[model samples]
Structure formats: C-alpha cells, structure tokens
Target: MRFATWAGGAGVVSDAGLHPLPSGVSVLDLVCSGLPAALEAGSSALAGPPVPLASVRLLAPLTPPTVRDYVAFEEHVEGVRKSIDGVGGVPPEWYRAPTFYFTNPYAVVGPFDDVPVPPGSERFDFELEVALVVGRDGTSLAPGDVDIFGYTIMNDWSARDLQAREMKVGLGPAKGKDSATTLGPWLVTADELEPYRDADGFLALDLRVSVNDTLVGQDLLSNMGWPFEELVAYASRGTWVRAGDVLGSGTCGNGGCLAELWGRGHDVPPLVPGDVVEMTVEGIGTIRNRVVSGVDLPPVQAARPRPRIRRRDV
Candidate 1:
C-alpha cells in the first residue's frame, strides 16, 4: 500500500492513507524498520477525510530522527573516478557493503518546495536517489533485522563547484552537500514496490530525472552495488538505526548533473536561479524543487546621503 504524510493546513503531514498494520490503528507511527505495520493498519482503517494529494505539501515521510546517505552506486563511483582520478574504474573498497554519511536532517524539505541554491554556486546539480526510512529502533541488526517501511525519491541537490573545491582539500563531502536536500510526494510501502525488485535482490525500478523538460540523468534500479539490507547491516555495525531515520542509495551510475553532462561541452550551463529540477524513480514518486537565488538583506543607507544639511553648511 502507498502511505503519505502531507500538509493540508499546517506544517504537519496528516496520515491520509496506508496499508494494514499489526493492530487496528489509523495513524501510522514510526516503528523499528519501516512503517509496514502502520501502513497496513492505515490502509485498513475506515476512510478518513479525503485530502486531495494535489493540495497537500508532502514532507519527507519520516522525520529521520537521523539520516545516513550512502555512496553505494557503482556508476557514480566510476564516473567520478574517471573524471577526477582519470581512470574508468572503482576503488577496491567501494564494492564492499554499503557505506554512508550523515546528511543534515534539519536541511530536508518537502516536495514542490523551493531549494535555495548556495550563494556563489555555479555548478549546482541534482542526484536521483532512493532513500529508506527505518521504522524500528535497534542496534547491531543482522541481515533482514529490519523490514522496509517504504521508499521515496530523493534529490541530493549538489554544488559541484563547492565539491571540487573541497575535494581538493581532501576533507570530505562537506560543503559539497549542504543548504538543501529534497524527499517525497509520499512513502510507497514495501508491499506495493516488492514486484519491482529483481530476483538478484537488487531493486529494478526505472529512475530518471529532467531539468526544465530536458532529460539529463537516467538509470535502472537493478544496478546498485549494495542492497538496502546490506547497507543497514553495515551502517548499524557500531551505530544504532532508530525509527524515522533515513538511509539513502547514493547517486546512481550516469546519474547526477556532473556525470550526465560530462564532456557535453566546455560551456556547460550550470544551475542558476529560477531553474526547476524534477526526479522520478519508478514506484517511489516524483520530487520537484525550484532553485532560488540567495540574496542579501536590506541595504543600509549611507547616513541619509551624508545629510543634505552638509550642502547647506558648505
């Protein structure tokens, strides 16, 4: 079943619809793993007020008490390698279990929201990713320890210029990722999306993105280096994954602004103010965010033009 939290009147995303839960409950709550149970229950509950999907502002399904975005896509790894490392290959360690980094939970915004482009960012780009929302709270979970509550499309909006600047310093992806991250439309429960994963255990959703009607990034879900479960186990090795936490499948191969536009031309146009970005991963949903330029506050007057009385004194 599909589950959604949306803002109809206030900032809160009310429980509109979902699948059946373990018990008979209408409102879905964050549990250990995904919201499968809550979704199940919500789906089975008596119909609530019909809040049209179009009218509500969809937030990240889960508040993600915490967030860990993993760089587990081989395509992205290889692409960056070829461009930066000048080799068309991946590092030996990149094939290991899904590895991740903490993304600022506070920086997350809902669907159809305006993502503020960092000031001076000339190469602002987009990443099409799928994020898992942990429903249960646990520590050191074994494989299959947690069940997925659902999946959502994520736009890991990137600042390529800042990224290049920081990577040269060898610090990390900081500054490369800040200011804004987008997720949602709604949380598609596991049951609804189970058919999309192939027998190889890799997801098989059709993921694609476009900027102002121009197709840029594209990929099949079947290509992820590590599945969600492995990432969960690897991530939870020393840390605990609590309910409402988000785990993302890093950028896809051939995905993102840099990889797609690579060699397109030396005069590649960078994202500027007023650009509209859209991402759609099959089964999840579409996320649309507009880029807005950062501006300075009100200008200060120069002492009222040095006071006209100065002319009278002269």
Candidate 2:
C-alpha cells in the first residue's frame, strides 16, 4: 500500500481510492504515535469514501522531525570527487562507517510541484536518491532491530556554485542545500519491496533520471557500497531516532548534477528555469518537477576587489 499526506489529511492509496486517515491526524502523527496497529491500519479500509488521486494536492508525505542524508554509494562519491579534483579513492573510513549531514526539513516539497532555483545560483542541480523513513524511536538501535517504515523517491536539489564556495570554508553546505528537497508521489511501504530484497540485504531496484526526456543516467540500488540498514544503525548509535525522520541514500552514480557531469567534460547544461527533471525508481515511483526562478531576499551583487589594497610604506 502507498500512503500520502495532502493539505486535508493523510491517506492510503489502493485500487479503490485514496482512503483518508482519521480526522486531524497526519502521517507524521501516526508514525509518532509509535503504534504498530496504526501503521498496519494504513493499508486497511476506512469508513468514508475515498478521494481520487488527482484531486488532492500532495505535500511531502510527512513534515519530517529531522532529515539525515548519507552518502552511501562509493561510485557516486568517487564520481563527484573525480569531477572536482581528478581523483578517485574511497575515504578509508567510508568502508568502516557511514557519514552524513543534517539538512533542512522545512524546505521539503511534494513530487508534483515546482522547485525554486535558489537566487545567485546559476549552477543549480538535482540529486537522484532513495529515501527511507524511520518509524520507531530507538537509541543505538542495532541494525537488526532498525525499523524502516517505507521508501520514497528523493530529489536533493542543489546550488552547486554556493556549495563549492561554502566547502572552501570547511563549514557549510547549509545554505547551498536549504532551498528545496522534493519527495514522493507517495510512500511505498517496506513490505511492498519484500520480493526485491537481495541476498546482500539491499533492495535491488532500477533507478533512472532524465531531464527534458533525455536519459542522463541509471543505477541499480544494489550498487550501493553501504547498505541502508548500516546507516540507520550508525544514525542511532548515540541518539534517539524518532518516527517521521527521513534518512536518505545519497545520489547514485551517474545520478548527480551537472557539476560532476561538466567537470568530467560532459556537455550537459546546468539546470535552469523551465527545465523539467523526472526520476523513476522502480517500484517506488517517479517524481517530476519543474524548475522556476526565485529572488534572494536582500539582493546580492558579485563581490569586487576593493581598489587593490593601497599599499605600503617604504
């Protein structure tokens, strides 16, 4: 069963219709309630008649309590690093553990919406990724004990120019990433993927991305160097992971932005206003978005060297 939350309330999508969750309750609320029965009930029928999928304005299924995005594919990391610096080697610690950063959850957007290109950014881009929604609170949860409620398509929108400038300072990708993140046509429950679970314990799915209908790249979920479960365990190592938190598997190889593509001599143009990006993850579904222009609040201008530091004494 697939679940989604819109302006009105949360609901499950079945062959019949989009069945609503109990009044005033949301997918976030249901997850936070931490009741297995509540989650189970999402797939069952409801009292009222269902709504047509086309009628509702779907929001990001849940307003995440927090979002932790991890880089799980070595190929993706290597591709980016090689593009930026002409180098290739997995960081020593990457094989030992997963690494991630917290990003703004407030900027999340639904699948069928327009994403604003952050101002002063000409190198805007999209990252094709898979996201896992945590459903239980567990402190230092063992990998075996980790509970993955569902999966969804994630487009971690980026401002490459800003990201490059900030990384030089060794402190932020914050503003570079805060503008928007697109998630979901709907959430596909874990049980729905049971058939595709591989022996190595990773879900195997074909993920492909396109811009303006031209295929850019594709990667299999099994290509991930670090599986999702291990990342969840690392996330819970010393903290409480609550329901409604989103854990992302970072961009798949060849599934990243023009920054890496251009760096490698690919002729792709950077994303701009009027471009449409569509990503399809087998089973989960496709999420498409149109890029639109946006203006920065305080208005900014390119920095100019202040007359060259008038010089010094004899």
Candidate 3:
C-alpha cells in the first residue's frame, strides 16, 4: 500500500482514491508500528469513503525522527570529488563501508512545497535520490535483519557555495544542507518494490529529475555501491535506528545533482527562484517543488581565537 499524509490526515492511496486512516493515527504512528500493523490499519481504513487524490494538498509523508543520508554512489562521489579537489577518484575509506551524515530532520518539506534559496547562498542545487523509512527499532543489525517500512523520493537540496566553504573547516555540510530536504508524494510499502528487485537483490527502479520541464538527469537505483539494507546496517552499527527514521541512498550516478554534472564539465545554471524541480522514482512516485527566495540573513561575525591552554597532568 502507498501511505500518505495530506491536509486531511494520514491515509492509504488506492485507485479508488485516498482513504483516510482513523483520526489521530498518523503516518509516523504507522511507521513505528511496523509493516504487519500498517497493513492491518490500511486494510481496515479502506472501508471509509475515498477522497480524490488531486483535491488534497500532500505533505511530507512523515516528520522523521532523524535523517541519515549516505554517499553510496561511486560515480557521484568521484564526480563531486573531481570538481572539488580537481581529481577524480573515490576515497579508500568510502569503499570500506557506507558512509553517511546526519541532516536536520526539521528541515524536511513536502513533495510540492516551496524550497527557499538558503540565506547567503547563490549556488543552490537539487540532488536526485531515494530514501527508505525504518519500521522498527534496531541496533547493530545485519543486512538481512533490517526492517524497512517503505520508500519515497528524496531531494537533498543543497547550497553548493556554502557547503564548499564550510567543509574547508573540515566539518560540515551543516548550514548548507540544513536549509531543506524534500520527501514524499507518499511512501510505498517495501513489499510493493519486491517485483523491481534485481537478481543481486538491489532495487532496479528508474530515477529521473527535471528542472523547469527540462530533463536534467537519470539513473538506475541499483547503481549504488551498497544496497539499502547495508546502508541501514551501517547506520545501526552502535546507535539505534528507530522507526520513523529515514535513510537516504545518497545521490544517483551520471547526473544526480548539478555538482556531479559540473564535476563532469557540464555547465548547468544553479537553481533560482521560480524554477520547479520534479523527481520521479518509477515504482514509488513523483515529487515536485518550486524554488523561492529566502529571508535575508544578517552577516555573521568572525569567531574570536581562544587563548592557548597550558597542558596539565591529569
């Protein structure tokens, strides 16, 4: 079942239309309850009258408890590294394991929401990717043990100029990335994607993105260095990956983002106000968002140098 959260409330999507779940039960609640329970809830809720899908305003499927985005695509990593470092190659550490960084959960936006150009940013960009929602709490899980609730389209919006400057300090994509993240249209249950899994067990869904009606990039979901299960397993290494948490499959190869294309010598213009970004993952669905101007920010003052501390014996 495709689950969604909209102006009306949480509901199940069907050919008939959107069937509202009982009042007070949210998509988050369903995610935390795991697949069996969500299936039961969706089945029971279908008896209610359905609402036209187009009439309702869709929202981000759920407010994730935490969002961990990985760099699982070698092509994207190599291309981005070449652009930033003037060399094309993947780091050795990257091959050892799936690496990820935590992005702000609160920065999430709905499928069709307006994303503002982050304050002090000029090189705004969109990343085409796929994300999975965790269905149960788990830690140190093996790949086969990962419990995923569903999948959705994710746009990891970026401010390239800001990200470039911050990472120089050796520590962030922080403010550059925290500006916004788009997830939704609706979340398709994991079972719905089984038919699309390849012989190696990787999802073979087709991913495409367009900027203002111009096709910018396309890739296969199976291009990742590791599968979603492995990404989740790495994420659960020592910390708990609770239900409602989201794990992104990073950017796809070939042209997942402007940066990747730019690294490959493609001269694409950065995103600007009024530019609409539409991304689609074959089985899951599509999400469209428009860029808008952000609130002007006051200039930040440079930090003062701290006095050197004398070493003392413990």
Candidate 4:
C-alpha cells in the first residue's frame, strides 16, 4: 500500500490511490496520526476523480512534521572533504555512527517542479538519496522500534560555493542548502517493498541518475557503508522519532552530486535556465525537476529575511 499527498487545480488534498485520503489533509496527517486503516479501507471503495498528475503540483511527500538528513555515506564525506577544503579522507568520526541534523522541511518540493538555481550559485549539483518515512512514535526507542512507513527519492540539490562558505564557520550546512532540497513523486509503503529490505537489515537496490539523458552516476545499495537499520538506531538514540518525521540516507557513492565523485572543476557545465535532471532509485520511484533561472522578485525577497538557524530545545 503506497500513500501520497498532492495538489490539484482546486487545492491541496490527500490521496492514497486505492481510495482518496480524507479531504483537506496531507499524507503527513494520516501517517503521523497513525491512520493506516483509512488507507487500507480506501483501496477498494472509492471512484474518486482521477487527480491528473499534470494538473497537480507535488509538495514534499512527507510534510515531515520534522526532518533530519544524515551524512551516512563515507564516499560523500570524502567527496565533501575534497570539494570544500581539498582534503581527501573521511574523518575518524565518519565510522563512529550515523550523525545528522534537522533541515527546513518547509523548503521541500516534489518531482518535476522547477528548482531555481540560487542567487550567485555557479556550482549547482544533484545528490541522489533515498529517504525514509517514519511511522512509529516513541521516546528514544531501541533499534527494534522503527516501523518505517515508506520510501521516496530525494535530490539534495547543492551549491558547492555556498556550502564551502558555511562549513568554515563551524555551523553546519545552512543557507547553502536551504533552497536546493527536493523530494517526491510518490511514497512506496513498507509492505510494498518487503523484498528489498532483506533480513540482513540492508536495503539493496540500484540507484542511478542522469542529466540530459547522459548517465552521470550509478551505484548499488549494497555498497552503503552504513545500512538503514544502523542509521535508524543511531538517529533515534536520546531522541524520539515520531510519525511523519523523515530520515534521509545521504548520497551514495557514485551518486549524482559532483562533490561525491567529481572534484570542483569546470570539467562539466553548470546548471543553467533549462536543464532537466532525472534520478531513480530501485523500488523507490524517480524524481525529475527542471532547473529554471529564478526571476528577481524583489517584493517576495524583501518580505522574507535571509535564512538562519533556529536551535531546537532538545
């Protein structure tokens, strides 16, 4: 049973495919609220209007009541090392356990949406990641407590220039990453992917990405330095993971983002006003977003302050 939240010409709505989700709500509302029954029952009883995929806009699949993206890939860590400071090895802490931080869930968007190249961003890159949707709720549950509702594809679109600037300040990747995050298309439920999540507690799948029909990156899921179970276990320590929260499994080695495999050089052209980036992960669906040169809307810019960090009470 897969679940999704979407928008239509009329307005935003909930939809589970078999049956429409309750009106005026989102997938986050249903999953976090623990109402899988509504999804189960809807599978066979509704002739709801077919929400045209084209007419509707896709918001981030998980409203995430909260969001956490982890840096679990050692290759990406090494890659980030070289991209930002010309360093070339993973830090000793890279193998300790999965470490992560909250990102702005409000910045998420769905597949096929137009991603604006941020102001002065000359080194925009794409990161192919698989993100999990949390379905269980508990205060610091053990490794056994995670009941993931589903998975989706995420493009941690990045601006190498800004990222390099922020990391030097001791604070994590902030404004550099604020506007480039993208996710969506659909959320494939756990039940629907039992075969991929094997007994060994590893998710094995083929992940790939391409730009303009040229395959720029590809990798197998078995290569992950840390599997999903390890990530969930470490991430849940000393903190509660609730329904609707999201856990992103960072970018895999050989994945799209240039910082992961290619170094910071002009060997490749940067994203301009009209480029389409399509990424696919086995089991999880593909996400395609077009890059558009954003219009300089001064009013909208003035109304919003520059992005900044807000520490949580935890």
Candidate 5:
C-alpha cells in the first residue's frame, strides 16, 4: 500500500483518494511498528470515507531518523568524477564496497516544497535518486537481512560550487549538501514493487527528471551497481540501521544531475530561483520542488591554526 502524510494526518493512498489513518498514528509510527501492523491499521482505516488528493497539503512522508546516501551507480560516478574532482575515471576503491555518507535528516523537505538556493551557493542542482526507509533496527546485517519498509523518490539537491570547495578540504559535502534533500509524494510498500523486480532481483523501474517542465534526463533503476539490499547491508556494517532511517540509491546514471552533464561537456545551466525540478521513479511517485532565493550572509570566519601539543617520550 502507498501511504502519505499531510497537514491533517497520515493516510493510505488509493483510487478513491486518501484514507486517513487513526488520529494519532503517523507514517513513521507505522513504519517503526512493521508492515503487518501497518497493513492491519490501513485495513481498518479503509472503511472511513476517503479524502480527495488535491484538497490537502502533503508533507514529507516522514521525518527520517537519519539519512545515508550511497553512490550505487557506476555510470553516475564515472560521469561526475571529472567535473567534481577534475579526474576522468572511477576510483578503484569504489569497487571494493558500496559506499555512502551521512546527510542531515533535519534538512529534508516535502515533495512539493520550495527549496532555497543554499546561502552562498550559485551552482544549485538536483540529483534524481530512489531511497528506502528501514523497517527495523539491525547491526552488522548481511544483504539478505536487510528490512525495508518502503520506497520513495529522493532529490538530493546539490550546491555544486560549495560541494567542490568542501571536497577540497577532504572532509565534507556538509554545508553544501545540508541545505536540503527532498523525499516523498508518498511511500510505496515493498510488496507493491514486486511486479517490477527484475530476474536478478533488482527493481527495474524507470526514473526521469525534469527542469521547469522540460525533460532533462532519464535512466533505469536497474542500472545501479549495487542493489538496495546490499547498500543497506553496507550501511549496517559496524553500525545500527534503525526504523525510519533513509538510505538513498544515489544518483541515477545517464544524466542524474547537471554536474554529470557538465563533466561530459554539456552546457546545462545551474538551477536558479523559480526553477521547478521534478523527479519520478516509476513504481513509486513523483516529487517536485521549486527553487527559491536563500538568505544571504557574509562569509564565515576562517579557521585559525592551533599550536601542536608536544609529545613526551614514554
């Protein structure tokens, strides 16, 4: 079943419209409680009168506990390596395992919310990705042990100029990425995606992105180098992955972001205020956001060098 959260409350999406869940039950609560319980709750809620989808203001499906985004597409890595690092090939270390980085959970916004150009940023961009919400807590998990509650479309909004500078410091995509990340429209349960699973067990869903109503890029979810299960497993290694934690399938290949196109010598313009960016994952749903101007502030003070501690001989 597909579920959504709106200003009123959480609801199950259907042909009739949205079937509101119990007053206090939220999408995050259902996700933490597990699928069987959510199914039971949804079953009971279906008896109530449905609300029209267009009438309510939709919000982000849930506020994730944490967000881990992985680069699961080699094509995306290859495409952006040059532009981001001024290098032309995928790094050898990337093949050893599915790698990811932590992004700010607090920065998440709804499918149709307005995303501001991060303060001090100019080259704003959007990344088309698929993200899965964890159903339960687990540590040191294997691929088969991953538990997923559902899937949603993710737009890992980027501030390319800021990201490039941060990467040079060998530490972050921090402030550059912490500005905003988009998830929602709604979340679709794993069972609903069964029909789209390929022979190799990967979801073969089509993904597309558009800027201001013009199609910019499209690719297949099947193009991912590592499946969601594996990415989850890697994320679980030596750490706990709990319910409501979101893990993204990274950027899709072919033309997931403007950086990738720029690396290939394409002259796509950076996102500007008033530009509407939309991303769609076939089985899931579409998430559209409008870019808006951010609050301008003066540059932060630079870090000062600290005196090194003298080591005493043992």
Candidate 6:
C-alpha cells in the first residue's frame, strides 16, 4: 500500500484511489504503530471513499524521529572528493562498512514546497538520492531482521562553498546541509516494492533529477555497492534505531550537482531565486520545488577577533 500524509490526515493509496486513514492519523503515527501489524491491518480494512487528489496537499509524508544519510555509492564518493580536490578515490573504510551522518530532521521540505536559498550561498546544488524509513524500533538487528517501512525520493540540497570550507576543518558538512532536504511526491511501502528487488536485495529503480525539464543525472538503484541492510545493521550496533528514523542512500553514480559538474568542466547555469528542481523515482513519484531567495543575512563587514596560535618548541 502507498501511504501519504496530506492536509487532512494520513491516508492510503489503494485500488488506484486515495483513501483517508483513521482520523487524526499521521505518517509518524503509522511508523511508531508496530509497522508489520499496522500495515497488515490497514491493508485488510475497508478504506474510506476516495478523496479528490487536487484538494489534498501532499506533505513530506513523514516527520521522522531521526535522520541518517549514508554515502554508499563509490562513484558519488569519488566524484564528491574529486570535485573538492584534483584527485578522488573511495576510502578503504567505506568497503568495510556503511558510512553515514546525522542531519536535521526538522528541516525537511515536502513536495511543491518552496526551498529558500541560504543568504550569501553562491553555489547551491541538488543531489538525487533514495531514502528509506524505519518501521519498528530495534537494536542490534540482524541484516535480515532490518524491516524497512517504505521508500521515497530525497533531494539533499547543498551549499558547496560553505561545505568545502567546513569539511576542510575535518568536522562538518553541517550548516552547509542543514538548511533543507526535500522528500516526497509520496511514500511507497516496502511490500509494494517487493517485485523490484534483486536477488541481492537491492531495488533496481530508475532514479533521476531534472532542472527546468532538462535531465541532468540518471542511475539505477542497483548501482549501490553497499546494501541498506549493512547501513541499518551498523546504525543499530550501539544505539536503538527507533521507528520513524529516516535513512538516505546517498547520491547515485553520475547523480551529481553543479559542483561535480563544474569540476568536470560542464559549467552549467547555477541555481537562482526561481529555478525548479525535480527528483523522480520509478514507483515513488516526484518531488518538484522552486528556489526561493533568502534575506537578512549578517553583514559581511562584521569584524571578528583573530585566533592566537600556540608556539611549539623547535
């Protein structure tokens, strides 16, 4: 079943119709509601009459309790690293396990929402990714026991200039990434995606990104080197992975932004105040957003104290 969070409440897309779920129900409620049983019951129950699609506003379909975005594609890793410096190569640890980081869960943007540019951000970019949602909370889950709730398209908006500066300090991609993350069109449950799974358990979906109707990047979901099972398993090693947690399967191969593109000498037009970005996944639908310019940035002329360096014995 395809589930969505709309203006009224949570709902299911079944029999090719949009049916309202229990009143006051939200996607977060479903995530925490014992996924396997909830889904089974929801699917078995009689759904309410179809709601007019146009009348409903689609939100992110989820307000996850926590978000962990992983870099699982070697090509994306190499491209990102290569873009920063002249050379690029995947790190050895990447092959040993899945690598990820925490991002702002409250900063999520839904389909059709307007994404504002961070003031003074000269290099804004888009990343095409696949995101997963956790259904039941579990810790130290075996790979086979990692039950995923659903899937969606994730557009990880980026500020290249700020990211490059911060990452050099060996600390963050924090302020650079925390501003916005676009999710939706709607979520397709894992049961619905069963047919697309390969023998190795990876979904072979066509993921793409477009700007103003022009295609920029495309890749198969099967291109990923690490299975999400490892990601989940690793995430649960020491801490509990609660229900409603969101995980992203980083950018696909050739699914790059203006930074990687520019590094390769493509020199595409940069994002401005009103450009539209669309991300689409085969069964999950698309999330389209417009760039809204930001205002009231701190003045560049503000003075700051200089750092004092410590002397070392020669």
- TM-score of every candidate relative to the true structure: 0.82, 0.91, 0.96, 0.85, 0.96, 0.91
Assess candidate 6 and give its TM-score to the true structure.
Answer: 0.91
Q: Cα lDDT of model 6 overall? A: 0.81
149-205 per-residue lDDT for model 5 (tens digits): 999999999999999999999988888789999999999999999899898889999
lDDT of 2 by residue, 195-311 (tens): 888999988999999999999978898888777878788999988888878999988887555655765667778898999999999998888999998876665566897887688
Model 4, runs deviating above 4 Å: 9-19, 35-38, 44-49, 264-266, 295-314
The 10 consecutive residues of candidate 2 with the worst lDDT sum are 81-90
What are the Cα lDDT values of the candidates? Answer: 0.69, 0.83, 0.93, 0.72, 0.92, 0.81
Clashing residue pairs in candidate 6 (N, C-alpha, C atoms within 3 angstroms): none
**TM-score of model 1 relative to the true fold?**
0.82
After superposing candidate 3 on the true structure, give the runs of residues whose Cα lies further than 4 Å from its correct spot: 305-314
Q: Which candidate is the best by lDDT?
A: 3
- Residue-level lDDT of model 3, residues 38-68, one tens digit each, is 9999999898999998898999999899999
lDDT of candidate model 4 versus the reference: 0.72
How large is the C-alpha RMSD of every model relative to the true structure?
Answer: 8.7, 4.1, 2.6, 6.6, 2.6, 3.6
Which is the winner by TM-score between candidate 1 and candidate 2?
2
Candidate 6, residue 240: the lDDT equals: 96
**Regions more than 4 Å wrong, model 6:** 15-17, 44-46, 299-314
- Return the TM-score for candidate 5, rounded to 2 decimals: 0.96
